[model samples]
Target: MIPHQWYIVLESREIKPGQIVGVTRFGERLVFWRTTEGELVCLRDKCIHRGASLAIGKHHGDEIACPFHGFRYDKTGKVTLIPANGKSSEVASYFHIKRYPVREKLGWVFVWWGESEPTHEPVYFDNVDESFSWSSSRHLWPVHYSRAIENQLDLVHLPFVHTNTIGRGKKTLVNGPVQVVRDGNIAFWVYNEVDHGQKPKKAEDLPPPDFSRQHIHFIFPNMWQNYILDKMRVLVAFVPVDESHTLIYLRVAQKFVRLPLLRKLVDFLALRFSQVVLHQDERVVITQIPIATQLHMEEKLIPGDLPIITYRQMRERLKNV
Candidate 1:
């Protein structure tokens, strides 16, 4: 996994007040819950005392009480009240459990990974706001998080994997697929002109990204967006469940249908179509050899892979920065 970056792990709606949600992320067992006032809290799921799962414990206001010994903890992972001891007992400093910093933005939950304090707010795209109604779905992919991300960055596979859907015209040749990486964000545009049985044009020969057209982009950690049009988009958050598993949170957002009731119907239908396309990609992605990708992996690469190569380079650069 990449170091010192904010990764989107869950949608904001998944956690609710007075409830503890437990899941394994980044190969670590974690539990998330909200205080009565609705502030998000994330902590290691294990109780430091007997190594029991904290998720099964009871939640009282902001404090969660261990079911086995009645040890209670606050949002900061500090033991606030140990029922086994007197109510006025002072908890030792060593009694605290591990806590992780969390933030919510754009209806997604982000967790900061690594030791360094975050220097900037979580990065998100503009224009995709509450005005655009969204519907979300999640799927578990038995591949590394990087592989799931690189699948979207791949431009050459559309015609082959999605031949019956997005690749209807058989535009087998690729051109330009220019990329611009700046400010920890990467956006790339494709210029796929019907090949006249000629060699593909180099990335330098193509124009820079035209945001007005349909394109794809990646935000530093694990968020991605495909701008289908001015009022339509498809977003994906590739969550690293572990070294060999990833949970993809896919959402379809649109403002084309403004009426509330009609919009729900439209969004629902759109999501179904999106799911079909996603499964098409999933079938092929799961079969990739050595599911995890490396910056220096052995493969015959071509000029059409400029976006993917840039993504790998940026990931390597972010590891130290």
Candidate 2:
């Protein structure tokens, strides 16, 4: 079942100022654009007149003019002007498109992909802001969006899947209990301790060590954030291209501290580092068979999979609602 809520569709940079891009997600053809004033809007791509794709049309300042018959639409999906029609009444009665609500936050464009009004505003991390430096990349994968999302929520596979890279030398099984917390549409999983070979210890084994922690948060439908530490973070937004394909937007966020040279250097390194880690995850996720299969009755899950179960149940409940 598909969860009904706003999903992160693209990184904000994918649609530049005054540029319009066509995106097909979850069987919907959408036109995403930024106004001259830098506001973002997303609407159904099909024009009411002649069934032309509005994404292939031109943008005149704030309005998008359909290329086929010069039908113009405003950001709200109302046909503001129709060149073929003489009066406004005719255009008003026949020329409207479905417009989805869009909100820009933390360098990403979020779209309400469901039928109902979103119950809450999009969530943002405390460290995400203009002061923080960030860079992003986009990749289209041959897998369902749910599979891509579940890959992020799985902690037990990291030690084996990413062994040569991010998970090198990490413990295979985590010792301490995994902590799970939720608020509305947001869910977070924190693995506090790793088996260090001596004896099973609690999360607070080294009393007040450092500011290092492993934290991953999934905000509703399609956004996931992993905090490697205080200074580095990885944010992933998954957009469903179809039932069997997905587009992934990866953002690496780091503290800049007002130093231009250091910021540039950090941003460059972060982008490369993120790409390496992402490719590792993608290699495994895309190879999974039966893209749209549900996990409720297939496998034997244990306590380590509590987070995954929670996410799956939430998705099922939301879809039923």
TM-scores, in order shown? 0.96, 0.87
- Model 1 residue 261 distance off true place after TM-score fit, in angstroms: 2.1
Candidate 2 displacement at residue 45 in angstroms: 0.4
Per-candidate RMSD, Å: 1.3, 3.2
Q: Which stretches of candidate 2 lie over 4 Å from their true place?
A: 1-3, 87-89, 185-212, 256-258, 293-295
Per-candidate Cα lDDT values, in order, are: 0.88, 0.76
**Tens digit of lDDT per residue, candidate 2, span 183-231?**
5344444443456566644545433322256568777778788877777
Estimate the lDDT of model 2: 0.76
Query: Which number leads on lDDT?
Result: 1
- Measured by TM-score, the strongest candidate is 1
Which run of 10 residues does model 1 get worst, by summed lDDT?
114-123
Off by over 4 Å in 1: none
Question: How many clashes show up per model?
Answer: 0, 0
